[model samples]
Target chain A: MPGWLLWLTGYLVVRVRCAAPERFLNLALAQGLYFWDARWMGEEWLEIRIRAGDFRRLRPAARQARARVRIRRRVGLPFWWRALRRRPGLLWGVVSVVAAVYVWSCFVWSVEVAAPEGWQRLGPGDILAWAEENSLRPPVLRANLDANRLAEKLMLDRQELAWAGIRLAGTRVIIEVVERRFPDTATSTGPAHLVAERDAVVEEVTVIAGQARVKPGDTVRRGQILIAGIMLPEEGDQAQPGQGFSRPRLVSARGRVWGRVWYEAVGQAPLVEEERVPTGNQVREIKVIVAGREINVKPLRGIPYASFQEERWWWAWPVWRGFSLPLAVEAGTYREVEVRRHGRSLEQALDAARARVTAYLRVQIPAPAEILEEQVQVLPATPGQVRVRVTWQVRQNIATVFPLK
Target chain B: MAQGEKSSGGSKLRRVESSLVELLDLPADVVFDLPRLTVIGNRRVVVQNHRGIVAYTPRQVRVGATGGEVEITGEELQLEAILSEEVVVRGRIARINLRLT
Candidate 1:
């Protein structure tokens, strides 16, 4: 018989001791009893196995053969069931553990959101928040989730997402997303003109598919069309066949226009600067911040110096890379300093103000624009401040496509 | 005189039955109610159509068959299973003896 069937039916090993154990075996066989693995253990003792139900039948045969039968071991389901019944707590523990594992497997444990490569605007947290709103959050029952429907809804709700795939792997829910691809230029191919993005003096105009509106040395204002999409018939052209004078044709304007643009900025600095020079005496204090409130480890007395500067360094608990808990330890250092007023010469003040203006201009100018001319002017100084203004003339492409409504 | 006549008649009947079995190409063990022993590489033995186990020991095992007893002598011989019609013995079998009683 199969081992599993034997286990299910249950069996017992019995040791029979008698002067003639063979007689006991014959008597058991005669009684229609089934047994196996009968081995002689020396000194009139024999060990054999019989089904749990047939164990009692061996008693009559043992009596007829004058043998003493004692159960050596119990094997299979009946003994296990009896043992489990005797200890209700252990049985309950085993049952509860199995049930807990089954229940836990029914819910999602983790949620992962995967985005397209090089996509930076959308993050996993944003997708998770959106999923939470859609009832696809973690710890949700897997039975209630429809992967196809959820994926369809995600793509429909998020315009940037071109495709979405949601699947469950064990206890984790994985959401893969692809972002929509957009063309470099506007999708519309209708007639459009290249207009000046900002006010500039036109230096060169090259038209590829439209009529040139402005020539070299022409001054143009913002929104003025550099190349016109609508082209009229040339003066020498004549009507053909029955057609009247050729009508104007519309085409998408494409070309580059180089212009000289001017950029200007102004900066001011105080003539007499107030400076702080450290006095070398400093004190340190430690503080702990829970949530948004801080508690000092030791109370600090009144300030020792009238003029002082305090710098604090905070060490927060890092729960994850690039993320931290609100709890933190703050170390503050206070250095005593003396405030003094420093008088600057007129040339020095002008230089300081000019430096500030140059820094401001660097941020305003585009990288590819060539600087043709730069002029800095020192405005009339106010009573306690120096004022300077800087201007830059740069050559760059100033054309931008403006679709015709 | 009656006993002699009966013995002779039984021998004639046996001869006829054996001839009939041979003529039909029937299995002798099934037709003649004989024991069939299957030995596997001197490691295991299966006895079919056996009466019962007569004795069992680590070095020897005796099983009763239809008309004789099968004696198995080996080292650490074990009765793996025993049923009404089959008995399986497993061990390093050294010898087997079939004795008619």
Candidate 2:
């Protein structure tokens, strides 16, 4: 046996004989000494021996200390009995094995494949399953699905997609889409036979292309053929054989189809104004964010605004154990701005109205359309108020040409 | 022994003994008990620990002292006596002065 084993055996024999074993053990421990070879030998028995110097020190007190020590030792008997009966050493061995298996499975197992944008209307679950079947899941192939590439593929497949992109942060997948652009047929293809988009008298015809079928003074209805694309053979050429009677050719024609267009736009300015002054007040606040949600630091009271708008968005990140979150807040202040105005004469208001109407018409009509005439009439409603009506005639070449065979 | 003779003898002896005691207790350093008079020639007076006199009147007198020369209002007075310890003041028989304790 080892030297420590021999020593522990002797100590145990001495302890069994002593009346106060606790004191002896304490004295031995206090002397900066220990018996290293106290092996537990089956149930109800522990064998140990103390060092020679420790044994001498404990010898005098051993008889009295032994009894107390034995009582203390008996106090832990129930717990030790349960521990021995349960055999925790074996239980812990099994637990460690199970834990190792769990870790291995977690690191090695494959779940699902997910490509956010490429699959034509594929849902998240479908992509996950694909990833699993293909063994492209995380920690295996180490291939990350390119969201931008997926979005591009989707766009290429669908011509109607105006704008699209894919966002993949962590495991979540998001596909953003914008609708397609549709061209306005009337404006996109310029000059489609200006046959009166509205019905009116032909105030003027600035014929830029094709044969003029109607003059400025002629009255026309909606969808009336103002300029004819079909031309009849000349009288002198009628005798020629195999000469068709009529031929369709492309042509351009334009005329001002006037139909008493009336428009009313009103602008108002205040006669008096109120100003704002500092009230010398202040408030403090604290804000907290949790799980992509914000709890207000303080509630607002007596807020003076005719209208107010608020919008909120949360950003989150996935962690190994849980989620990391942050919140962004934007505040907007709304106040009334005062506008001052003074009374003006009818003639002056009329001139101002005319200038405004001219500017508006100039923006609406293209550069080629020239204003031929303008007339303004002012109807006074009150001493300082007047209603101004302005009428103008403009001429332009709005014609279309079609390919002829 | 006659009673009148005894009374004269006792009165004379008592007077002689009292005078002898007074003489023995008198201040030997003092030459005279006359008041040492100092006229400031102005209304205001200044004294330290002044005591034992009668009434004192302080008039509107601007007094200033600089470089050992004291001026009472505009009037200049030569310092007749100046002791590091105490000052004595005497003036015309207009008013008796009590020094401040």
Candidate 3:
């Protein structure tokens, strides 16, 4: 028989001590009792393994053969189960652990949010807070959550999101978001004039349905009209200077005009600045946290630094992706630091201020605009401070429609 | 004179039966009440159509057959399994002998 079958049915190792052990074995075999691994331990002693159920039948054979059969060891599953029955506490402990793990698996342990590239208006924290308000928080039962319906509701509520997808992965919830894209150009239906959006030197003009007021190389103010909605008659079509044959026609103006625009920004930096320098003295504390209660793992006195910077790391017991145990380890490190004034040269301060101005100007430029030239100027400022002004010249569309009253 | 005739007739019948078995191309062990022993590279021996275990020891094992006993002599011989009709012995088999009644 296979070893597994033997274990399942249980077996016993028996020692037969008699003058004629062969007679005993033959008698047992005649009675249809299965035995295996028969060995001679001595001249008059024999060791044999028999199925547990067949061991009881060996007594009559042993008596007839004038042999003594003593069980040397009890083996296999039945004996183990019998021992377990004697100690209920150990059995209950094993069962309790299995049940606890199964119960823990039925609830969500963590949640993750993924947003598309170039999207930052909504963060994971914001989405989690929204889910908390909607009763979809972590540690909730998996059966109670409807991922598809929740995703649909999220898309309906957040106008900025074009699409939302929620997925339940074991003990974790994953949410993916895509932001809505709006068209850049907006159209006006009524009659309007295309005017300069900012003060710039006109570079070129293409008129589609209007008369061009400014040409290339012309300087225009912010409100100056680049294309007029009213078009006068051609020179040949006019009757005379005082008496006009044809009247001016009013129509919506549609055109694109390019211009060179300049932007200026100011930045200041102090020559002497306060800096915090670490003294190389650091203290660390580690603790194990279970259910929000912490037990210190490292023995240490209270932190000694009056002025220190602290960095902390928390790690939870991760079972798998989207699954974790409630047990966590938290480690905190505190580094002592002292504040001191650092001095820099005037030239260095000026360079620092200029970098600040450049960074500020980058944010103000539009995506479609192309930078053509740059200029920087140092200005007089208060003592111990440097002030720098930066300018950028960019080429972009300057035409914006203004409705006619 | 009658006993001599009866012995001769019995011998003739036995010879006829053996001939018929050979002509029909049947296995001899099955046609006649016999035991078949399979030996595997001097490592183990399996006896089929066994009557019972006659004697067993670490170095030797004897199993009863239809008309004789099959004896196995080896070192550290073990009766891996035993039943009324089959017996399996595993060891470094040095010799095997069939003693007829």
DockQ, each predicted model: 0.44, 0.00, 0.49
RMSD (CA, angstroms), candidate 3: 25.3
- Which regions of candidate 2 are displaced past 4 Å? A1-194, A197-209, A220-223, A234-292, A304-326, A334-359, A380-385, A398-405, B1-101
Return the top candidate by DockQ: 3
Tens-digit lDDT track for model 3 on B1-101?
A: 99999978977986898999989998988867689999999998999998888888788889888778999999999988877778999999999999965
Which model, 1 or 2, shows the larger DockQ? 1
**Cα TM-score per model:** 0.51, 0.31, 0.45
- Candidate 2, B1-101: lDDT as tens digits: 59989978967985786677578885421322222334554432443221121211221111112112222222221111122222333222233232211
Candidate 1 lDDT, tens digit per residue, A233-320? 8875663556576888898899989999998988888989889999899888888989989998855776688899997667878778
Tell me candidate 1's TM-score on chain B: 0.87
Compute the lDDT for candidate 3. Answer: 0.86
Residues A82-198 of candidate 3 have per-residue lDDT tens digits of: 999999998898899999999999999888888865464567777788788888877899989988789999886765677898887779999888876643345577888998888
Using DockQ as the measure, what is the rank order of every candidate, best first? 3, 1, 2
Q: Which of candidates 1 and 3 is the stronger one according to DockQ?
A: 3
- Model 2: docking quality category: incorrect
TM-score of chain A of each: 0.47, 0.37, 0.44
